[model samples]
Target: MPKRTATMLGCAVLLGMLMGESRAQTDDPSGSPGAGRATVWIEPSVSVGATLSSNGNASSSNGRSELMLDVTPALRAVLNTARVKGFVDYSLRAEYFLDGNSGNRLSNRLNASATVEAWDQRAFVDVSGSISDQSVSAFGPQNLTGLADVNRSETSSFRVSPYIRGTLGGLVDYQVRYALQTLNTDTSIRSDSTSQVLSARLGSRPVGQQLGWFFDASAQENDYVIGRDTRSDIARAGVIVSVSPQLNVTLSAGVETNDTITLQRESYNITGLGFDWRPSLQTSLSVSVEKRYFGTGYNASLEHRTGRTIWRYSASRSASDSPTQAGSVRLGTNYEIVDALFAQSIPDPILRAQAVLQFLANFNIPADAQNFQDFLSSSATLNQTQRLSVALNGIRGVITFNVSRGTTSRLDSLTTLGDDFDSNTEIDQQSWGVSYGHRLTPLTSFNAAYIDQKSSGSSGISSKRQSVSLGLSTRLAPRTSGSVQLQFGRFNNTAGSYNDAAISGRITHRF
Candidate 1:
């Protein structure tokens, strides 16, 4: 059979199932005493679209067209009072592209949970399971090229977990959870492999007047059927103390350990302290400092809001023993300009802007003291960069518009990475769009939008793109609705020019 015929058959099946479910629910009573209980309801939808593209260059032009179909089905359920009350959900999705250049794909997912209540709703037990599958075809266009190549690949995963939580004597709360995850990978050039991961977490909180404390610890073990093994463990604790009605302080610290089956193991220790203060109803500030064996950093921010205007400022810095240091600062503000004009009938038009600057130093480090000293003495200068962005938005009734622009400048000494990675380069980009919607009747509406974008990079590369879309939605019956959409786009670049068009539609029924 033809691809189009198969797609139509799939759509018919999906629609039939949805209609059957809706009809079944009509005679079912709502969950109540002495009610004939129905345990589940499933909803599904399918859509088909066609895409056509054409390209023209100074020498030649090429064109192609493709028809694509997508099917998505969802499951949802509610259970009655059986010492547990929860829902199970599952989805199956598949897509087919008519053009032989692209291949078909299918994906499946499942999630379910169960819960039990104890001690008058103060304690509970929860169990959950999740599974996923993904597969790709071999006949599609190749993505990567190497000496040893794979024709096709598939991956599947599953996870199971159980946990318990409750408050103790109305003063303290505690919780614990454990999870096991397994993965299977299949490839054409290599033998199939499997892996497993086991993880556990335990935590508790102690309540007090004006002061609270909490602690948590976790561990994970990873084992591969045909690879090296790894393990990780972490422990953390923190405290929150209220100094006044408007002031609070927080302190936290943690340690992490990593072990490898055949390599040197490493450990890291980290600590941090922070606080927040509110001097008035419209002003607030926060600051924090942190240190670790690998690096050190600090951050702070201040914000104020009054009437229809708001302002903010922030800064941060970090240093590493590996001979690298970096810092950044930013200032931003937003104002409601139109709200002050029409307080009753119209909403506000808001404008926002921000400016940021940063500096970085790069140097090499080694275990040998002599090598590290020599590396620093070579004289490396710090690089500086700056960026700025501004945007404005407005809304009135069924129409909305937004516009934004951004620019970046960097120093020339930072051009060692690539032509596109030069520090002395300047990049400018801008985008603007508008959307409108109108309701012709209580159950019907029309919507449209037009968007345009342009961007340029340091390598003198520039491009422009624009798109226009229109859609209509309507209710065909009391329990059924449908929508149709049309879109067109054009793109122009230094290398070539391209144009594309597409049309799609969907219909759904609900109980």
Candidate 2:
């Protein structure tokens, strides 16, 4: 049996044993007086789900399916009469891909904690330890290949960490932690690696009402075999001050350094500040500004809520000396119109429906300075999108519908030095979809969805796509559930037509 399956079975057996012991104690006519003092409790659960997708485009006409199983079991011991307590939690997970080309992955994690109270429960010493392992397969395009080609790689990693926390008086607390991680890879070749990290933080709350401050920092180092070695280090110092119950401010600065075996080392410094205000019970706002060696930006937003209505809006702008700059603004709102109309209805099927529209404008690209300059000088463009969504609920199921339209303007210039450059471009796109989900029983459900999309570009490029999917899920046992899904999609691209279909299933149990 697989490791995950074995672990689930072991947990089931343990739960059975515990139940039996509890029953025996309850049935004893002359139970031992001390028996009542023994405290034992366990909680376990598991879940498994899977999805499959297939595309029609020849270049992407492949099908893929995934199955995952997860289990978690925890136990806790609390001695209210004593000053000590402890708890332990463990989790196991595994995933499998139906596509013959895909590899399976697995993970296991464990956490243990203990705490001791002192000073009339105002202060305490807490300790915690954890261990985890993760393994996964990799396959995809590589820079070394020149063109996209098949290549496979697998990596397994493990981590161990421990930490301690304590409080001084009633106003201050601190914590420190350290962790070590190791990684191993097996493929046509083999490699090994290790890393270490250390972190610490301290915080305090003055005797006054609603004021606090904190500072944190960390550093890490990595060593590798069969590859260039690298090291990264960072230190941060910051503070938070609450001016009043409704206003606050925060500021921080940090330095970062990076070095590689065969590459030149680099270092930089960063600083930032932010402020928040809740002037009233229903309104909140925040803003921040920052600048780096080559770039600077600022952002701000405000939100308000009353009864069943909520409104929100935000805008931001950024620029860099690399001769690149861009800015955008957005506004939207959501309201529970139906709930207000049917306040007396026991279960309104039309829970809510919302319509939203947004516009985006882009100018200049720092990374592609040449292309951005040519396009901007030849064509000034504007883009906008509008969306609408509706949701309905019933005793057994829920349904949702969504639609969106998008458009972009013309481009006028092709060359950096072209005099005729009057930037202008025109493009349009539309998409719509509907989805439904039903709960057949306490442990079973069904879901389905359909979507259609079309797009046209100013360069005479046009395409359309359609997709449909359905799935069913049910519980096989108290702790185990199984699911199956089917999906199909077709696309008519500017180059050609494509279609694909796929079906997949999975089973999972929890402890």
Which candidate has the top score in lDDT? 2
State the displacement of the C-alpha of residue 64, model 2, in Å, after optimal TM-score superposition.
13
Clashing pairs in 1: 410-423, 411-423, 411-424
lDDT for model 1 comes to 0.43
**What is the lDDT for 158 in model 2?**
38
Best by TM-score: 1
lDDT of 1 at 10: 36
Off by over 4 Å in 2: 1-158, 167-172, 182-193, 206-215, 224-228, 260-267, 275-395, 398-435, 440-444, 449-467, 474-483, 489-498, 505-511
lDDT of 2 by residue, 160-181 (tens): 3446677878677787766555
Worst 10 residues of 1 by lDDT: 353-362
Estimated TM-score per prediction? 0.49, 0.44
lDDT of 1 at 372: 6
After the best TM-score superposition of candidate 2, give how far the Cα of residue 206 lies from its true spot, in angstroms: 5.6
